[model samples]
Target chain A: NGTLVVAEHTNEKLVPITLNTITAASKLGEVTCLVAGSQCAKVAEEISKVQGVKKILLADNEVYKGFLPESLTPLLVAAQNQFKFTHILAGATAMGKSLIPRVAAKLDVSPVSDIIGINDTDTFVRTIYAGNAIQTVKSKDSVKLITVRGTAFEAAQVEGGSGATEQAPTVDVKNELSEFVSQELTKSDRPELTSARTVVSGGRGMKNGDNFKLLYDLADKMNAAVGASRAAVDAGFVPNDMQVGQTGKIVAPDLYIAVGISGAIQHLAGMKDSKVIVAINKDPEAPIFQVADYGLVADLFKAVPEMTDAMNK
Target chain B: MNPFDEIAVEEAVRMKEKKLATEIVAISCGPQQCQETLRTALAMGVDRAIHVLVDPKDYEGLQPIHVSKIIANAAKEEKADIVLLGKQAIDDDCNQTGQMTAALLDWPQATFASKVEKTNGDLQVIREIDGGLETIKVKVPAVLTADLRLNEPRYATLPNIMKAKKKPLASKKPSDYGVDMTPRQEIVSVEDPPVRQAGQKVENVDDLVGKLKDAGLV
Candidate 1:
């Protein structure tokens, strides 16, 4: 019944959206937070405070800087030998997403991703076809690795848990095939939609690019990411990166703000993952409202500006 | 490729220039039965294909990390400009392989590309974001994993199907590329999703709304 949780460490920029660790910890036994970095003891100290963690194994190494799966996978495989954990869990972010599969590779088991619910410790349920349908799978293997969809669990929950830290021997990383290159991060301070804790999204009813300024202001006030229903993007109210729908991106922010979005099946498929959805539409019965935790039957133009202006006060 | 295809639409959406591959070699990792997907890709548009075969006995519980390693190895060996994959395979529904493969190659990866184009030493990929689209331009020598919207993969016409037989289908094993096929984690079981309680078909939208609101949907 031993479980291991892998953590994403660094600049503290994207730390809050990493629910995959906590989510995985929630479903497994004796969750161990995995860390690989210099000052990793500090990272482990911070992550062990997240609720539900049982242990922290810190493998602080300078070579573990950015991330190369070939190098890191061996370390995780070695952890498996030591912990004999039945489950290995991670967030579905750039790092967690990259690392879990390698753990699976080292273990030779299927890694289930983006699960909506974990049924028992061995069985999990997730959405496929972009949340259109739910598929439940149970792992026959003893050592199952999972990458939690980023939005399912709350992050602030990690602020007060405890973990016992352990040290392991360094793993010999071969396949130093690709040299590390500098990364160019997008400069905007807005939260990334994928891991956003709160999001304000718009659709075609938003009208135009300029109108989106209202959404931006509201999102800005909320300190949230700006996402768009495909309709809003197609209508040119916003850029494509703001898109949230079946073919767009999958988001599960804690509080989802939907304005002027009519909730096309495709659009619903995207933001449906949000924890608490709020819908604002003139129509009393947009399909979006059906999925919303709160529905405001009113025009967004009148509602949004006032909402932002109020938040401004 | 058809102008309305998934990748084509992606290219158009991104506002990037497009070109044919220097030579498109489709890479696939699967059970022996998965060879059909390769034939399908060849019939669709790829110049040739490579099949990294898994031992028939060991194919079950085959993970994407292994597949990504095998494919990335092949792609690296070929010095591929772009490595293309369906966002998630239809069978396992694990979507991490393509992006993880990019990580292994230490190459920039663009996922959910609706369109792909290469021009002027820069590659343009249109990713379908939430409400709108964003066309990102990265320099050439990156990996792009495709979604269903990228291109409507062509069905192998009779002639192409016949020609696919002549096209090279290189077969390699997991060991050839140093992939450990052992399952570190195993599935305890798998079953169907939870069942929705059967409901009476409401006679009207009003009834539907009433029922929905009662369920806390409204």
Candidate 2:
């Protein structure tokens, strides 16, 4: 009868996608957010401020540092066994994608990933076939485990209600199989791509890695996150982490500006949900123009700078 | 084979070539046509193949949980040291089988792996996270799922394809693995996603910016 939201955080601040996941969890029932990390009391405090969360279950330990599936899965299973939660939810980010499946399997339940719409408690709407088709699916598992596509749901407001915090039941935290070595996260001052309000993306047409600076310059004018098409990433023009496509990160910003991207089906699968799409490319017949709200057929080399200057003016 | 799974098989074949391991066994659970996929793996230098045959009707009902259980059973029966899988199946795009199989077997799981190096019987895996790459170390008997950057899958050459026919390929039912191929989720309906109609073709950068400003998107 109750929902459990596994809060994703970095010990310092809560990831914004957790808010969207909370919104989805609130739809099912009262939500209890589980915040597991080393010295993550701040995250639990942050979760308590969000509206609709009924309780905050905080588990502070060292083993959960990396959020490894080996350690985190056991904790989730323990929480479910004690709480008897009807549904367990997480954002469809990397951590959730890697962890929820293990927890679902241990619980002997099937997990549905990247659900977009909730038809009911058991049914959900999701896009398949690279967003070409949308399917509404109904889960028969006793405990529904799901990963919410953050872009599909509006984030639950950070302010409003008060949820009581409680210590989660302790589980065996000894993990010997896996050890966290290190991480090389891109340090960016720009807003994260998935959560940004405006995104400016490039493609293989950018020609080379240095050419991405043009898109970045435009993005700087609008305070937008810079992204790239899979083609751009495959061409070594940018890191794959910046890729926006069916296989990459999905983003639904308020405004999505495509420069030189041809709008492959996979690329559209990621950003087609944006509210305002503007395409700037020399090829008038590129598939990107078909889905764009504003199409500008021009050389991006000149058009991007002009657009940046116009915005500056 | 799914594109990512092809990368997994290719990585395994590369490992064998480096003398990192002894044997490579390819497993697939689907309709009879899955043999074709398993054959592709064999052609890519897999030592053998196992196909858990399910009727097409029953195959559609199988979810990742069931598939993971089936794989876990086979892994146990085969006494495998490790399991490698694709990050996702492109058709269903569940992206859960590897982690779930690891859970079913109570083994360590490293997913979305971009790089894997063997060192002293332990695996150092660099995985693709949302922001960037994260490296971790896991002992043998772990599960690793290959990401797009893992490796380029080799094509099944004509000679290898002919030789793959002679490789050992065994078929078993889901029942043989004690897995229930039950539909945990029912597809209510499937329809085309909402289409975006092409809007105004702007004359220049200013026109486009003006339109966005009017819409309060700027």
Candidate 3:
């Protein structure tokens, strides 16, 4: 069996790509990475230390300056044709969600995305209903292309190992739908929301931008990233970056704090994955309380400051 | 200006620009009425249109995982350099489709595109990230999901609408593409979520805080 891992060229620190590759590879066959950029050979070599990685192929081209799906799609199509992989795996990342289907399309196959767990050789488990339901699927297709969500399995171990890095051929791109414009990421020294262990969220009940500072204070005390209910962001209490919903970031922290929030289906889609959830809202019957491990019926202004003080103490 | 922004009939009319090496085709998939969205691109001057007719109702029960497969299937047939969809459909309100589509295709997918420019054999895609914007240069043939700010979609005049009618629209069956329209995890029904009862509004911060403290919330 053959597997091609689309790896991140960024760093040695663990990312979803490395984790997905190693797990998918360990289950299927020999694992090889398609290191798709510059300054990635080192990272690829480091990934080789993962339990199952056999080799690394670097498809570095001046054309692939950024994460160019247009350029890389052709290369991946070419790689699949050359490698004859039984399965191709990538992270359920922005690139992963956007690009893998093109590869399956070029090969005249279907791509299964956002799969959370692998059951057997051909069976996989994925979450549905915004992580409320888990569905297990067994593919009838001979080859499978999929995007594995990060939390599905444990990350591949990293050690010091060297793997061969080869250049992947360039794709002759024809029509581009849109060009690379710009990207602005939320700057946080703390762990990213999805990977973080704790998260503090706010809602429209927080009222305005100034009130978000309370959530921020509690989050800072807990070293958590401030999250928002869909209403809060949609109501202009904060920017969309802080919004939590099916259309926003999906986070699965160990602890999630819901302050002044009335949970809605849209809002619950983002943070339902927290191991322990605490809801603090004036209304005891708030939807947020339904899913919360701990529910507090009180004014958030008082509860949050006291909680923050308690934590500080 | 983004070639995609304010795409009026003028851009297509002024086609003699030496800088533009290739023509642009707009691809959007959904049920029959989705062609209406192509009007803005047509008015602004898209070369053609690719429409894959799939029932919108089928999406009612399918999750983001299922929709991504459907999008990838439709995108595969277009043969366009880039794939552009709204960051989240106003109806489904699911923002993960773009990223999910990117995953299925194994391509670099950038979401929340506000501006787009072509230079040096790469597309200069301006993406709206957390704080501001980051310029990413991806070669053609990538997927870019559009934000509401990407363009002020123009209204199609009777003439433009008539002209857009002449543009090609091809329909591909999901079965032909070997994709199962039957959702892997289908929902039985939809209902409004439970709501919260009315809450007490304290007179002042002190009283409110004190009440909360007394209520054990503090």
Displacement of residue A237 (Cα, Å) in model 2 is: 1.5
lDDT comparing candidate 1 with the true structure:
0.66
Candidate 1 per-residue lDDT, tens place, B122-218, comes to 6666654332345565545666666545654444589978887778888878888888877533554454433323123233334433543465433
lDDT of 2 by residue, A247-310 (tens): 8999999999999999999999999999989999999899999999999999999999899888
lDDT of each: 0.66, 0.92, 0.64
TM accuracy, model 1: 0.68
> What are the models' TM-scores?
0.68, 0.98, 0.68
Question: Model 3 - which docking category?
Answer: incorrect
Q: Which candidate wins on DockQ?
A: 2
Winner by lDDT:
2
lDDT of 1 by residue, A55-119 (tens): 77888776676554545777888888876888888776545654676567456566787666787
